[model samples]
Target: MVGVPVVLGVRRSAPVPVPGAPDAGAALVDGYGRVHRDLRISLTDRCSLRCTYCMPEQGNEWLARSSILTTDEIVRVAEVAAAAGITTFRLTGGEPLLRADIADVVSRLARITGPGGPVQVAMTTNGIRLPDLLPGLIAAGLARLNISIDTLDRDRFHRLTRRDRLDEVRAGIAAAAASGLRPLKLNAVAMRGINDDELCDLVDYAVTHDAELRFIEQMPLDAGHTWDRDAMVTREEILATLAGRWDLTPVPGRHGAPAERFLLDGGPATVGVIASVTAPFCGDCDRLRLTADGQLRNCLFSTSEYDLLPTLRGTDSRTVDAVLRACVRGKLPGHAINDPSFLQPARGMNAIGG
Candidate 1:
């Protein structure tokens, strides 16, 4: 994870190709005609953690520095996405902090100039290196942070991820809060036998730290493909487990964070459930993923992709806009996280920048 300096911060209003003028395609137009507001850009395909739900079971070779996107190239892609009406720029990766010049990249994105559009920039990381990086990120215009912490048990953490940076992740959370990461979010995947008993404990921890803790379903993304109904700790069960211990007040959302949030005790700390399996909210979904390897994935379930790097490096602004628009038009309404007919892909979450 210590491979590159990250370029953080993205400007949403930078001049970019207009919609369908010449090269602008259907990317600006969604199924419901709402312009794309959020863009997820993967910075690198390298990661240090080998979480069971993410990386390969045996582990794979990490990407070299040369193969990852450059600062200018990443900004160009963000500019095109902003031109396509994307307002939220999330720097994601196999691990975003691994990319060199990430801070520079973030700064460049923040200065992009487009009329009447101000973008919010953020990053999602494994939190292995946030302690030393949060200050630089905030100084460069990072708006918020999302730290992925799956469980609290140290041994289970070791079993799930081959590393033992749990303490580092905690330190990162504290450092991020002190460094202006307001309302930090902690994304957790609740495994059936792994950490399901810690549901109430997780809520308590969230309340204690004033963090938004979200319990996500165990996805069928890893190459193992061993997910079953037994492995899935449904949303209803999660809610019941938490509610039985503490009173919950359902929290309403605006754009829908893909998680149904609820205040644990009518306070700032909230507990959310991302029930992609028990209850899929694909209809109101609005998300797109760009892999670190330059592939544009419309849906996490589909292995298919629309390559954007070729056009990104050679084409004019119009051509880039057209390709992005085409990819957006091709966005699926929702993903079948529960349908039995949908055989999930073999790639793990890390492969696609979860």
Candidate 2:
């Protein structure tokens, strides 16, 4: 509630009609000159666990099944993106595992080709069902994985997620490692009084499981709109906590990666911190998000969304591509979380892609 609250309604921005669509082979470049190649697609807005930092415990309306893009429609969008310049596709969601046909979706997206080559397909999941679904996903061409785990204590996990599924999550993490997935990552949102103390422990757990851990500074994307910046932990504090145990050496040339990686004690084992609040990386952002309901989001904190469901259902691929270009062209220079005039989006992280 830091910014002025806007009345909640349909925040979708009507797709603008352009004189003509940009070249089909043109890259997805915003006005700021950043060529976007990474696309985060939200398969569904429904999740298994109600994480306190993501959504509320109850009374939240879910996206209608009919409103969500079907498998065919999703493939159509990916095809358009692939034809353009998008080379990386990261499937996100309230919980992407909730999608019954997730393997099918991955198999189809893996076949897409971008300017680089065959587009890389990855996913960020809660990892509750990974134990049962990792094999199918791997066979379907999931190149990488990122699992969310904020705490190691079972009671703390239950309190944060409002679900008793830490064992299942751990099992899922194990399953990912067993599958021989390279660079398996664990994402933990750093909260001051919540999981801040467990920074080293989480890194240790990641090192033990042969997975890299990233500490993400909690942003203002909760469904309840009650995010307090003062309560959120910063990147300096996270590094300080870990530096108390090991010497964290900075890894240079991160490029467009969200996490600023550091070598723990100058070894193969490493840790990362995504300081979205204190240290914004919007200047080099090369990513775009498409919601399950077929809206293209330029930024994570975007107040406006470009509706693509109508274009997908009514027009040809060129028209859809035009909408996509327009969406990127409308991107703001940065997410002004530090600016007093900034306003939180009407939709939360679950509604947006994570």
Candidate 3:
């Protein structure tokens, strides 16, 4: 409401129980009994940097402006989602900072409340423009942030992202920490023969920056769709690499979180590994995705997407809630990336809202 054109004061409407809809007070539950509370919203598919693992260096087609969701439409869907028990919202994108109205979007959604109370808002970004946007975003109620920093080396950073902006990214990270966003997390995709050897160095860097480093296994979400399972760095290998330098103690229970965390040297500093490829956490997955084009995805690797734009624009709140509920009910048990019949999604990570 702070930066949006629409008027505030819209009341939270009650759920209209259509056939197959969840009971009035039920959260977004799937057949596997996973209650969906986290929603990842992609503000845009256009990015400033073209990471080799995400998209091509050039010639990537973006969504048409008319097809993308407006600020009003996004807030409306968030309201419906809040009513349906979504408690946490994460804004993602090819680069979420690419949108000029990002702070407005954050300010508006931060006001939405679900069963769990004031909804928590987070974001995943490449951090190129975070320094410029951090002040407004923090003032607008951005709860946390996850920045992608695959490699700390200047040349390797350039090779991985097709950009020589590592200094900008590092400055952004420092700025965020100085602003009191503590326990800040930095995401690094572990690619074999790429950044695998720098595991310990990355952790050291995190320690120096007062940030927690998370190493994610590269899944088949690339534009080329040529992901080879054999080439991806695994959780075991990552831990093993770190074991050479520090005594890692697995930091107990994971409550539906994708990352497996560990305390470095059995003390304060920590590191995490998101083994999405080798050790799948689909059973505990409570997240859903909303693309910039207004499509709802039950899973990151889901082959099917439920469109919410038409219902959002042409129908009432009840219909939009019904669509949201239906999408959750239709979630697959897992991504099934290891299955022989698995097929890569038609869109790349940039389009899919990583």
lDDT of each: 0.72, 0.88, 0.85
Off by over 4 Å in 2: 1-22, 315-318
lDDT of 3: 0.85
Off by over 4 Å in 1: 1-27, 32-34, 61-66, 113-115, 315-318
RMSD in angstroms, candidate 3?
Answer: 8.9
Measured by TM-score, how close is model 2 to the native structure?
0.93
Clashes of 2: 0
Displacement of the residue 201 alpha carbon in candidate 3, Å: 0.9
Among all candidates shown, the one with the greatest lDDT: 2
Per-prediction TM-score to the true structure, in the order listed: 0.87, 0.93, 0.92
- TM-score, structure 1 vs. true: 0.87
On residues 220-251, what C-alpha lDDT tens digit does candidate 1 reach at each position? Answer: 88756777768788888899898897788988
Ranking by TM-score: 2, 3, 1
Better structure of 2 and 3 per lDDT = 2
TM-score of 3: 0.92
Q: Pick the candidate with the highest TM-score.
A: 2
Model 3 weakest lDDT span, ten residues long = 3-12
